[model samples]
Target: MILTYAKTLMFLLMSYAMAETEVGENDLNEVSDQVYGVKINKCCELNEIMVDSVCRLAELLNQSMWEPQFKTEDGIAAALKYFNYVTGVPDCATTQQRPIFDLGKSEDELNLLTDGRLQHLIHHLHSSDQIKDDPLITNTYSIHEAIAIPEVKEPSSYIHDQAKYCMDKIIITSSNITGQYALVCVPEVIINWKETSFLMKKILNPLFHAIAMVLYLLVAIIYFVIPTLRDLAGNIITTINICLIVSQAADLVRIFTELSNHVSFMVTDIILYISLLGAFFWLNSFGFYIWKTFKSRNVFLRVTDVRKYCYYSSVVWFAVGVMAAMAICAHFLLDSGSNPYKKMRLSNTIILEDIEQETIGWLGIAVFFTPVAFTIIFNLFFYVTTLKVIKRINIYGRIHYKLKGCFDLFLQIFLIMTTAWLFLLLSWLNFDGLFYAHIVVNLLQAILIFYVCVVRQSHVTFLLRKSCCYAEPIPTGEWGDEMTHMNGGNY
Candidate 1:
């Protein structure tokens, strides 16, 4: 009886244990099903959110382009928020809230948004036929690219950085999903109202500069070869041409190479200043010489010594050099860990900085351009005085001679210096006319110099006439007082 009872007890214990095991297995299966269902639902919800976010972004971008008063920063911020929410990344606002212009806030915002995944999203959006076809979408995308994209050394590395950086920003939750990635790019923007004028300037400025440089070089070479061409005017013109050539050559280098260092920035800055200051100085010298020539006509009756010319030239060069040096020194002293010349790229056939801060802010402007401003004022005064003298002489006698001289002088002033002043004014006012005027006038500076000093000169005409067998050798005496004054006199 005792053995039978023990067997029954053992059998009951085994049966109960087996039943508990079955129940536990069933509970586990049910829990797994619930978990899987939750995952699918969450993923579906995320998909819906992403789709909605994308559509909203597209709408915001379109609105930004269409609405003239739309704040681009606000639009970008809103788009970024939506993008973050959909991508399982925290919104920039939640992470750090501040104004758009706040440097630290801006940097943080950019870091949060610029992950590889966002870049991938941008690439996909940009490549869509619908987005490409829509002008509003295209322009908005361009603005984002300009403001958001970071420079990377390698294309593949950009992708890797994007992925790694984005992952760092995100928490590795069980529900998260990884996606394919690609790079993004933005096209430059153009306003429809000013498109024609801007485009013309963009195309013509470089073309004209190249043509002018070649012409100046050829003319300078000719002046060097011909003994008769060697004079005070010729020497000044040659120096001006050399400065211009160096400046233009630097400009070309900027177009080809990305100048990211302080040395290149300083060199480019110096070269540009020298070109501009040198040209204005020489123009002023011409005006001064003309005024002096007319004033001393009867009293002095002779050209100023070449030594005086050299002295004047040295003074101008030294002054410009000082200004350039000051600008460089200021940049070094007031660096503030933010350089004005950084991440420069070739754009519209010119080297342009992606971000341009004043060299030392306002101080830089004051130091660099004060002398140029004074020079411009003095040149203008000289020009007016010379014109008045020419008019006075014409009233007394030599009407034809005075008229020819006045016309030549007028052309010289207009081409060399007047246009540059006009550019400054128009640029300050942000006038649309500046686009065409600046390109045409500034790029053709060398050509204008050539015309004033060589093509219009009587000596050149006589030489050309003789060489071409178009006329016999005219006696130097019969060439008129204008030619004699221009050749023998310093004016």
Candidate 2:
């Protein structure tokens, strides 16, 4: 709505306070070739000049119909602004570009746009408050609009400030980054909710699959695998680690064990599609540390630094878990819906997808680099310290003070874990799924830890065993016997 037509439609709508006609659909086609030029009229009775002809003249003569325009972040933003304005709804959050934009193709090109055109469209959005603002047209994620978000858990009333849903939801079952750089993002996205329900009736959630009480007891005892070392292995590093591993493993087994019943669930084959660069770095360093330890023979790890790493990783991981748990709790407790309990069951994975997509490159850089900068500084201090200790204390010293292997082993794990964190950065870049990337690295970490504890330890133990074996044979003949003979000769 423009002020130049103020005497006409403006008076009708405002003074009359309720008139609704402005550029009727019937007249839209015939109304104008007059956007920027002189025009003849189909409505000949009214044509002194349609007067709105030429943008400049219309503005100059107090007869403007259209507002000015400018660019926003993307062309989609511009489209969203105009559409939301027209439709009276909010904007949509978009997906992470899968580098698909880099390819050359026709549809791939920016939609038949002239340079600097969107800039013109966006300028108008800021200038006028009186014009009808469309929700679809300007999806500036200002936390106020009412477009549907993934869960629709928070029902914000403003159409423009609402949230959008993730097309595919996956609840990350495990975010383990301890062992082999492994993490698993388990999909709890329930696109196939009906099928899941039907199957649950038959299989009964696997843990409680048996219907009869006796059968339930028997089944639970038998298949439940009752938490053991065999179940945990060296892979479960902490309580958090154990919980994550079991939960994800159970989730996977539940889905698969009840495959026919829950067949409709659309799960990502994360193992296949995802890359584990984190695990790669962890393993690469694991091998390096092992080679150094075995060849140098005097290497050992310190326990203090191990405690420190464990403490911090646990704290950070715990906080992340708590935040996630609280969010789920809040959604369930706060929703005014009649069945919040039922809704909490899914705990939607689609939210992660939306987050993964919406986060831009700059944020990605910050997330990756912040930990990275800290890790580098930490590692530099330890590395220089280690070298200083070596030069000063001297491993080859005759006293044979015993804590050497322990110290080196501790340092080995420290260097491996700290240096390997960058694996996550590279992993995020390569694999879109963070959970799976963690799994890959964590698995490698397991392999490394085992190799360090077993293989490296075995070599040291083997050396000790040999030394023990030679104790009897080497004693007098080597040094003591020679000294005795010399004394005899001297006497």
Candidate 3:
């Protein structure tokens, strides 16, 4: 939906320029003289609009309002209006038709116009090849030039707000037309929006999430279908898959909601928070179970599987609930106006600064990563402890094939999930280069789980009978069998 609207806006801009050419009308010199105090008869033609002037009006000056409006539809709509006015959208009074003084006379109208003007302005600059990578100038170089220009000094106060605060810069060369140095402006939200949309938001996100949901359902069905496979490990894996399904579903829903511009921010965020955190806790439980199994001298310390599952469920769900509650409280307590998912990602790592708390960055880290950090640390400990226990057992006798297999499966899951999340954290930390890696790894999670649990499991092979001939029964025991000799039958 965004892409289509953008294309239509560009078409209208070009059509307007073409129509002006037919009528032999020129507003460039007038706009440049009035807005930037520069006299120019001609400049680089972009829909008959000067690139340098647009840079100043769209980006350099719009920095103050960009943060508060960029995440919401009101800001996006306001941006289109401002762009139409500046670009001479049809019926919008131009300097030729009406006095320049008539242009933003009312404070309230200017306030409304200023909210989202940056979005469309950045779009035009990018389309004109004036921002991202131009042969004559770059965004960083443009900022320095803009700072030096006398005309830009009046609005220089907002220049300090850079990419970290969700803004980008574009270099504007004006020497050829104005007999003066070039100017610049940085673009943040719009550029990031396009890049993220292409990478995962608009296309890849829904595709991967849909595929993952299907895979999760398939694996779950197989787990429930095969009676012998419904052991403790199977139950844990099944629960994790279910949580993942929920997470993916929520993500898909969010993508649509954002595109339609009717977002229920609080509801979607809560669902995502609970489901994603729930998946992590369930994964942590898998690690914990393995470590406890190795450390125990007897099978599950003689505890029934039902009771054990109940205990695990309680702990995992409670942790998820606690994280959700903390996030909800932070939303209301810290900055009610802030939308942490501004960057179109799940984590609330990026947000505008609030006067009292400095910014919601601290709140995001505290509410989200604090529990995640602890979970990752504990999972690592469990993995290490399990390995040590295996080494000690190896010193005495060979480990059981089933136990070893379980360890391998759990380790694969742990590594995949850990690596994906680590890259996700790095991406959120402004590691622009690692975003592609993060996307690839994150999308492969469901595939990895299916491969490890369904395709490679001996019990699965036994149930499917794809590997053996004549449906002959394989002698592989169930995962819940007591390893009496290995650890005194306390499995």
Candidate 4:
């Protein structure tokens, strides 16, 4: 009786172990199905689907109490152990075969069949050609045979082929799984090329602009200290540089702070528009100054009226400010949501749409871009007229033998205006190559100003050299008079 009772207990334990193994197999199948569904629904690439499915299955195993007797610390290790046990094969770490199913074989036979290789299968169930030709063998054989069979033609090809039928099967199963939890377990999606391009622009814009600001600030200080550099044109250039610096600085701040608050966003927007308007006005001023200097043949304006220039510039600045303000107000009024200026974050792509639909948006865009466009056109006209006037004066011998100098002046004005216009043009076109070119040219604005206003002007260069060499400072009036005469009264 004692021996019989002991035997009965042993039999019961064996039955329980078998039952647990079967339950573990069922659990793994369910997990695999969920992972396959996630892959299909997301429409992942071939290799991505494999990696994602494996990772997802591991995640599911970790979350559930599947195979409690396996005694592994985490899901990935548990999965690896489970694969080893089911295949009756040791350390199948790199094997690509389907998950193990019951084969009604002894451990020795199973080991022989798998060649003791532990398989971690990523089956491309969509490839119909990989299935066996015999209907009975195809329907009854393990899914692992598609990958494991030595006779299978091009295993890699089979793995890469789209899993259409499997995808459909998984999709059908997904509807019953609440919340589709397997998706959460997959690895984070990799950023595509489009997102990478935007990210690069975001990072580089602020960094390059900040460097430009420092250069501009240094040039501004030089203008203040060097007496010969202090002139109407110099002052205008300095102001333009300052405005650009402010605008770019505000943009940098907005990028970092994410334009989180309405007040911050509005302040940044207003400052940006105002500064941009100022830059356009300054460019126009420079163009007009060149035209006026060449046409009237005087370094100083013949009328000696600076107030008119100031008035015109102020009108432009204020008009743009008001328009920008109205646009902001309209955005708030029309959006009726948490973040009105959220669209502005992707301003290049969506600003046109805003202008078409929103009243103030159109007005604001018109006020800003219209002035810029007109400035380019007017500058071109001024440049051509100035060139004609200079040529006529040279032929008549009214201006001294400085035809080369006059030509250089024309070239400088043309280049400055053209470069500025190109930036706006490229921005509007939104081509990757053109956009990057715009950034390069835009950042060089300060250096260009320094070179044109300080380095190129003989009087300023003389003063800069003298100051650097610790020589006595030249009288401002003497240098100014000399430069006036050198340009034939057209500095």
Best by TM-score: 3
**Cα-based lDDT for every prediction:** 0.45, 0.30, 0.51, 0.46
Q: Model 3, range 344-387, lDDT digits (tens) per residue?
A: 22122211111010113346446866777788899888888888
Model 2, runs deviating above 4 Å: 1-372, 395-402, 430-439, 459-491
Clash counts per candidate, in order, are 1, 72, 15, 3
lDDT of 1 by residue, 35-96 (tens): 54211001112222222113223242222211111113222432211122223322222111
User: How accurate locally is residue 64 in candidate 2, as Cα lDDT from 0 to 100?
Assistant: 27
> Which scores better on TM-score, 2 or 4?
4
**TM-score, cand. 2:** 0.27
The local distance difference test score of model 4 is 0.46
Error of 2 at 327 (Å): 14
Evaluation by TM-score, superior candidate among 3 and 4 = 3
- Model 2, span 1-491: residue lDDT tens: 56668778766668554333344543553443223222111111121112211112233434323221323435443321221112111122222111101011101111211222111011111212211132211221211111134444432211111121101101111221111000112223334344534344223333331222232232223212222111111122232223323333333432342232232221212221111212222222323333343345453333123453455445545544443444334434443222111011222322211211121223322432344355456545545654555556544522112234434554565555554455644644533355344444544544554455435653333433434665532212222122222333421
Which clashing pairs does model 4 show? 92-118, 97-121, 126-163
**Ranked by lDDT, top first:** 3, 4, 1, 2
Ranked by TM-score from best down, the candidates are 3, 1, 4, 2
Question: Which candidate model has the greater TM-score, 1 or 3?
Answer: 3
| lDDT winner, 2 or 4 | 4
